[model samples]
Target chain A: MEFTSETTANGVSELSFTVDDIPGVLWSPADATGNHPLVLLAHGGGQHKRAPGLVARAHRYVTACGFAVAAIDAPGHGDRPRTEQDEQFTAGIRARLSAGEPIGPQVATHNAALAAKAVPEWQATLDALQKAGHAGGPVGFWGLSLGTGIGVPLAAAEPRITAAVLGLAAAETLAEAAARVTVPVEFLLQWDDELVPRDSCLALFDAFASPEKTLHANPGRHLGVPAFELASSERFFTRHLGEGVTQPR
Target chain B: MEFTSETTANGVSELSFTVDDIPGVLWSPADATGNHPLVLLAHGGGQHKRAPGLVARAHRYVTACGFAVAAIDAPGHGDRPRTEQDEQFTAGIRARLSAGEPIGPQVATHNAALAAKAVPEWQATLDALQKAGHAGGPVGFWGLSLGTGIGVPLAAAEPRITAAVLGLAAAETLAEAAARVTVPVEFLLQWDDELVPRDSCLALFDAFASPEKTLHANPGRHLGVPAFELASSERFFTRHLGEGVTQPR
Candidate 1:
């Protein structure tokens, strides 16, 4: 994997790289003199590395909390070309949604496959950033929907991450993932999410082995996640990754 | 893959082979002087090739319908070694079932992966059997639950299979698979299945593109699948596969 780094005039640098052809972006405080805390951001399903939600969250964590944020497009999303499996999945989703059929099972099936592919990509990216001296401090995580589906499992397997924000998904295939994760977590749930079952979502949260966790359930649909939740997540990160000096003098 | 063949006292020749280290059993009527129809059977999750349901069904097909039947242990069953993914899947199932949580999502996730692995194995077995002269006639399929999950997709992808029996499972990830299947189908649904949602099962049955298909829904639990359903499946296979002169005398 190779990265192209660009520093903007506003003291923020954007680094683009590919791991096993998975496109990813990393945002960092360009003016930082040394290593900084890293927050690996995972985007929801059907989204990309630079998704607006992730971009806004990344920037907030960088400028507000002094962290380097990284995100990669999940398989078959963003700039990556669609494979045969992706086409099958997209066609199935479209057809099922049109018929008003339940899509939860199909999503879990595909997400499990994507999660297997994504976890190592995040690990590889973290390794690359550490070697470049741009990251390698306390690591935290934030993800929603598809992001949560993939991020929870990835974070569970990786010990570097100490905190997480997971939202908007159920535990069908994620129970095992949540059980393995012992990191502090702030889990958000959209109570009226049409595509996700409330009981399943709560079960995933309940399965978390984390010693410290808080559940934030808001009254909204899947897309109607309240914007205020972002602030709540930022504060969670601040308390975890921002307590120490992000950079050594 | 190596094979050990034994001609039993009942005049049934059993060929046990390992494909990619996956164990399988082939049952053929030794009295048949020539080629006969071949039916591939897939057992459910956590069950192996020697599963009582699959074995009894295979024997009836061989003796009653004179069809050569074959079944293989799914990736983690029988003699095949359990992979790390398989271990994760087993742990997930155990945790969910123990907690009284829905195992559907976990089932779909692991089945999808196992399905992906099992499909090529079936094709490979067919290719090997054809070369060995033990198979290569009208091809049909039979599987329920985990079997249906893997069998439906396998039958859909293999045009040589002229008929299939799939049921006792949901349509979550099977819509695309059922769409690709145009062969005759005998779908069996066990009503009141504690684990599989009924709506999802019917939806899958409705998604089948096959012009010749029958849905037989019985009132019973998942494990309480009526013993008579086997008789119904037998008639369906016989109607589809028994009419042709499967042997070249």
Candidate 2:
């Protein structure tokens, strides 16, 4: 499937890209001009681009901050149609798990393979943006929750990504893809957060090879953070993206 | 329903409280002695006592650390049976939004009403723990993600709760609850966390009226925090529980 862009009356351009060669939407600012910094926003597990609060917020911030943003729904989410092949793959895993068979390693391997296959689709979207005359040098990849699982690997694989932001996520192992991110990386974590263990997050941070990294801790729970901290994110992005804005202390 | 208790081989007793007024599970540890503090663990949205990762970690910590722990699944999550009444309460709001109707105030009012109704169920669990001799006087609450939403309000409503550890949660306005919490409150936040905005968490911390609060920042995302920071939680709980155990820095 080919990618396309449509301009909405609200001055937002909805760019459609392919996932496993299937169509998906990527919302961007239509009014953006010059060599604006680019951001590719990825949603988390069981969520579409619109469902993940961070993706929507990133779109708003990047657009408002004079940068172009492309928010994509992953292969199984949003407008991307699921094929019978995908269903069979998942069903096979479920069947194995239900039969009292140990499927953990198999599932992990399958996910890694799937992630590897999905990289070309992500790179294609970036190439499309470059072809659209919005090539703003290296793009910034922002991943939320499950998106982090995919984004970390993709960013490491694609050196075209200059910087990356990971929210509410941790590298499952210290030796995994997150440690491989050589570009400037920023990690955000919640302290009393029970959803993800804090030890895993700290371990991932300690494992990162990136010299340009910062960790910020604030007070709020999973969904509560973004609903409450738009300004802080705006400031963080501004500083990191070199937009020259700082939030008050 | 009545509450029940059974002693396990590991010298830890499991106390279960059945709520006839609501469908919920109250799991508490019955091993409180010599100033060993109690921890009340609350799970996130659409979750129950046995939710993977977070709940499991809480149980491990409570058992290993010699702290009494009480955990309850909220109204719509876990073993609790969902009712048509509950369905309508949330479905109505979604329907309204889907129909392009403005229902902001109505949703807020409904949430407030539902929270008011739900508070008693949690209070009942607390009362049952006290009655069963599972909880010590200086009880602390640890809420993960959506659990933090419930914990913040519960801590404010119940004066018996001596301390609180809220992970990844914040209200649009933090003053009312922050002012009401008389005990030490710890707010944990993540930087670059796409799950929750960091500013909202900071606002929540700033809103606290009590001076006995600490904020810890770590590297990682929402799920990453809990996955990585179990040790930090133990340290925080121990510091506030004050049972004289030296924590690992």
Candidate 3:
């Protein structure tokens, strides 16, 4: 199914779009009228729509707030075509690295090309949202983990996005990304989290360019955030997306 | 190759322990004196020691502050024995869940048992530390992600641990774990992180059994704790470990 439409408990309209050409899904509230701000939500590595609790919650918030939400599944994940060959390729690269062999320039270039191949699809989705009349003045993006890696470049490449929330991601360091981002952003950090180091995030945050930025730390493990803070996320999205656009019913 | 030791530039001892009987490496800092406190550091799922920068930083902090640190690699990761069969098993389980197929009770039980198997080994590690002539008074724990998962039970089972710093973990629902944790605890939260919900963390904090609880929020993503707060971690270990240890050189 390329897209599906449904109604929420509050009698609002909702849509879930599945890109046949890609391996991901996009969701939006039906009540998001023309010129409504669009929020594109990105998932973490090795996860799909259901992995992060925040996505669903964010959906609910944006829906109530009159903003459209789009949740995307990255390449090699979800319903996207994946093969043992791709896995083997990654494995081979990993093996070489583990054996203390430097990656040949060809291998690195091939990987980069593959990554570049996925960008247009993501950008196309953003364009589609704008064309659908759901995008307000500028788009907003929220990415986690690998999503952050992709989102950073996307945001930088497309000036159409006016604001972003890059949680656990950076272009160089958290500080560098922070400095590069001209939009309002909120960075989240875990004090004792072991998956992503504290230093990386701090360095990124230090590099943020916006004075409107803020850093929030909460207790919970990696892959455990959505279950930890549903209300706060609602508040954050609502604040950024605008008033009365999202409110818990 | 069972264990390797190095003195850091700052004069702290970095030690890695390998147990042939187990699948992973256990890294820590050699105690300055035999009488220093001991802390067990656990990592989250699908991550090695380097993934969570806080683990090593915490180890360094505790060691510099005159405590011993032990970091363990969990099952299915970090120099652990893993085979295609194990990957298949994990994939099968995930596939079944994704397809909405009912999981057999046997499979569930088997998986649960595998997780439970680590408990004794963790306990025995503490015992080994004690036998090594380290001062056993006021043992503590620090964990993020999977580490948080294991630390909860470990803290409950091991009465010797006096304090803990838990980031990005839910012992149970925040409500259940908070009620159960009788010791002083500090929780870290990232407000916009998607992997774990922020609400759950807040709920857990509210449920703490002791009054000596603190919540610190920072900005970043699901990658474990942020980097800028190494000093805070040092202070935390120092306050709990008791005085007389020197700060990092």
Candidate 4:
């Protein structure tokens, strides 16, 4: 594990790092600090670690909650090299979209292949972060769309993750993994999501074995999650992972 | 409206009142002087204006947000006199419960009858409250279970209500009314609700014409809404109704 670059702005310190060739970024409060809760963010399909949404969320957590947030490029995302399989997956999606065909099933298949490689990468990164004292406290996972595709399996296999906010993925490929996840989950869904069927989203939420799971569904297409949910997630993590700085102060 | 009684406790001023013959209670900050956003709470079946849950919610809104809260007893409920029809409704419910039959249909029928009277009574109460300067600002509604039964039509018919938090009733009797409710809404659903089928609740949420409606479903049965939801409602109302005193300060 090594950091390649660092910068500080707006009370947040952004550090770029790599572990076993997987590039990632970590955001934390700029001031010197002790160990605090860590939140791992997974970007959506076709997006990288520094996608605007992921960066905004990382900054929100770091500044508002005093938590460290990290996001790593999936196997073929961000600054990582893409394999032949990644090329084929991209071509398949383009063909389906141009044909005006539903792309959810194709996206799920590609995401499954990506998750197979990405889950172990996240585990290794968590290991490195903990060793460096950046993440030794309770941890949370935030991911949606392709993120949920990867997160369900990762949360199931990684007992280190105590809570998760996941959604926008199908249940057919992830329900079995979801059944194994017992951590409290906050699932998000778009009522009019064009990519995933509403019933499938509801089914995936049902499969989670967690005793405390809540589904927050809003009316809009995928990507139209209302802004207020970000605040809700802050409260959720604060409740489960100890207090962060009080928000809306 | 006539004030029947008044008391102050825990920074909240409780005022008992009657609009015509319908009994009700209103809660406000003890130091409240000016009119503020109002939230009207409709209690569940067999519960009254001062139901423990309603009172707790009223105080939370009053002391936390400086909002005036009101709840009025439905006809034949609370301090109101019961009619022969109310007697039959109670006898029918008792028989069905003992027979292991679902009481939803019976409850819906009775609530539909109650709502017919309750809606008009509510409008009159609002009229009086507004005239007396107790509630002249943007209004909100909070109700669940039988409260939803009454609230759906009331929100549709009452233009004063700009936002609402409602759920726990079936759609068979309320879908049309729900379709007319264009105000923002926060809908709640218990995933394992025994009295209402999960699909029915989803259908009701779907029927809402509000472009900003959100569904919050948790892993529990009726009467088991997690305590965290109260805080969530506080934020929801604060966001739509206007800033409340910052909570968790």
Candidate 5:
């Protein structure tokens, strides 16, 4: 683990780092000393680790809860180099769009493939972060869309994750993985999502084995989740990961 | 409206009053002076104005947000006398339960009758409260189950209500009324509800005309709403009715 850059603004410290060539950034209170609850944020498809929404959310979590927020680029996203597989997947989506065919199946297939590689990278990063004493407390996962595609499997396989806020992905490829996730979950769904069928999203929510899972569905297209949800998510993390909380529900 | 009793405890003032023959209670900050946003609390079937859940929520709103909360007994509920119609409805429900029959249709029919009488009483109560200067700001409505039955019609007919937290009923009797409601809504659904069919609840949510409606579904039976929802409702009102808020969403 190595930090390549560090800056402070608005009482938040931003540190850019790498773990085995995977580029990522961490945000925390500028004057922080002891370990804080850490949240791993995964970006949507075609978006990088530093996407505007991710940055804004990171800032809110840090300033409001004094928590550490981190994000890393996916296999072919951000400043990372794209392999031939990534190129082929993009072409497939474009071809489906031109033909007016639903692209969900192809997208799910590619996401599953990407998760195979990305999950190990995420695990290595978390191990490195823990070793460096930056993150060792209760952990949380926040991801939607392609992020959910990757997050379902990651949370299922990662025992360190205590809670997750995930959604906007279908159930076809993720239900089995979702069934393995027993931690508390907050699932988001777009009622009129263009890319994913509403039933599929609801089905995925149904598959979660977590007894404390809650589903928040709003009327919008895929990218149009209401703004109030961000505040809701902050409160969720506070409830599960704040001071004196040591058990996973 | 005439005040019949008043008491103060834990920084909250509880005042009992009546509009015509209908009895109700008002809760507000003990030191409250001048107008504040008011939230109308509707009790579920077989419950009263001062039900345990209602009182707890009222105290929280008053102390946490400085908001005034009020609750009124349904026509044949709380301290009010049960008429012949109420007696027959109760008998019918008891019979259905004994025979192992679904009572939703009968319950909806009875609720519709109760709502017809309760709406006018509520309007009169709101008018009297506003005339007395206790409630003159943005108004919010919170109710579920039997409360939702009455609230669907009340919010549709009353123009002062700006936001509502409603659910736990079906679309069989409330779909048309829900379509006329344009205020922001936070709808709750219990996933494993024994009384209300899940599909019916989903359909009722779909009928809301409000552009900013959100559905929060959790795993539970009819009376098993999780504790976290109360805090979430407080935030919903804060967003739509607190401070410098005059317009209904």
Candidate 6:
């Protein structure tokens, strides 16, 4: 929660900090008259918090929607020391994938564990941000792929999360976590995803316990998710967290 | 759970079956066996129930120690079908490891998920085996490496497990699971393990709630664990579950 750097430009400020190895960043309207609602973001697997996709989404949300944005590198993905298990498992995964074997079980196993650890980390991050007066008001979650697996459970456990943009995830085990998530959710999926089967993705969406949830499935591979989906995701957050204000970008 | 094959040789019968894709095998002594004490075996990471080491240990328990031994493939391994998560995670792991990067985070994520799924699976297997009258009397556990991560929680939750052979596991998260395990344990560790750090391994053993737990640290790398350790593991199980009878092998 220690802010290391702060830079302001065109009414939007970028703040960076080191929260015990969790390299984190915050984006807020620099000239905001008051504290803005925060939207805590999570990056996908093998990607850092500042991945182009996450950064763009954070910027768009803050610039166009008058919301504060925050994100951190998930445990091992960014500027963090890799542990021994990560090494062997990564090697094992590479070896198996090179052999063209189905790696869903491996992926599920990895994601599940990551999700478990991440919930606590996310919770801790929120607490630290709140204590430091960097985060304010209602919080929403946004993560696809690995993000959904972890963020779904995080949002489920944290009552403060009023809405979520979750998708691009599938696993029978994740269904258990999804069942706990009761917030309004905008779920996305790729119909022809080579890694996640259509049935499982659909099954995951169906398993969400949220009373007001929507599905937005596109036809493509895992990486072919349409760009338009992010717009809807932003809108979902805006509807739940905003006073219907769309500030000029 | 449902027996499909039974073979008898030299006062021992090996039973194998498919319990909804969880291939399992049970080794029981054939002669005058009033329901014997059961030793539920869990193999190491990336291994099946019938790995030579596991098979040899199971055989020893049944023949030399007069106990019934049972084991099944963990979710992503052995005779079980690998799912999409497994494939992707495995590939991601391999790619990271081949790049000479530390893969501890990756391995931790995978092992955490495996451990989460394994506990319930092991419980279900025992329940089914007991229902089918293939498992009886006192129950114990034996697992190392990935086995310890999963098996520790299993033994903790199952009050019937009076003793356990757990080791070669280390993670701050797994320590939470270990704190719940109060059974008598014979914990093993290779001082120079390539995967798990020595301090973390010791910390895991220290986290166990068992008052009668013992640590047997050997001088070797993970793969180079001496065969003598297994002998001691067998002895520990025998001391707790053994009824002063060493049946002829």
Give the Å shift of residue B220 in candidate 2. Answer: 17
Please write out the lDDT profile of model 5 over residues B1-249, one tens digit for every residue.
899999999888899999897899999888657568899999999999999999999989888877899999998899999999999999999999999998888888888889998888889999999998988789999999988998999999999999999999999999999999999999999999888999999999999999999999999999999999999998999999985222221
lDDT of each residue in A1-249, candidate 2, tens digit only: 356656453455666655345455555556545666667777665577666574557556655565566666677667777668568767987898689775434534444555665567778777776776765644777774556666778887898787877756655632377667887666666655545555566566656667566554444554444332354445445555656211112
Worst 10 residues of 2 chain B by lDDT: B23-32
Global CA lDDT computed for model 1? 0.79
Which of candidates 2 and 5 reaches a greater DockQ?
5
lDDT of 3 by residue, A129-196 (tens): 56655555446777765666666556656677766766654334223334566776666655445555
Q: Which digits, one per residue and each the tens of the lDDT, describe model 1 over residues B1-249? A: 578766653656687887666778998876574567888999888889988878888888877778899898888888888899888888988998899898887887788888998899999988888877877678889888889889888988898899998888888899888988888887776656887887788678778888666555545578877665576677677777774223322
By summed lDDT, which 10 consecutive residues of candidate 3 chain B come out lowest? Answer: B105-114
Model 6 residue A10 lDDT score: 66
Q: For residues B89-139, write the lDDT of model 3, one tens digit per residue.
A: 668768988998654432323333434655666777666556655435567
Give candidate 2 regions above 4 Å deviation: A1-5, A52-55, A81-113, A192-195, A217-224, A244-249, B1-249
- Whichever of 1 and 4 has more lDDT, that candidate is 4
TM-score for each predicted model, relative to the true structure = 0.49, 0.46, 0.44, 0.98, 0.96, 0.49
Which residue pairs in candidate 4 collide? none
Residue B116 lDDT, candidate 4, scale 0-100: 92
Q: Give the winner by TM-score.
A: 4
TM-score of chain A of each: 0.94, 0.75, 0.74, 0.97, 0.96, 0.94
Predicted candidate 6 versus true structure: per-residue lDDT over B1-249, tens digit per residue: 568899988777899976666789988887645567898888887788999999888888777778888988988898788989889888997898899876655666687888788888888888888888866688889988878878887887888899998888785658887888888887777756877887788688778887666655555678766665565666677777865234555
* TM-score, prediction 2: 0.46
Instruction: In angstroms, give how far residue A220 of model 3 lies from its true place.
Output: 4.0
Model 3's chain B yields a TM-score of: 0.75
Displacement of the residue B157 alpha carbon in candidate 4, Å: 0.8
Please give the CA lDDT of all the candidate structures.
0.79, 0.61, 0.58, 0.91, 0.91, 0.78
In model 4, what is the error at residue B152, expressed in angstroms?
A: 0.7
DockQ winner between candidates 1 and 2: 2
Query: Number of backbone collisions per candidate, in order?
Result: 0, 41, 67, 0, 0, 33
Model 2 docking tier (incorrect/acceptable/medium/high): incorrect
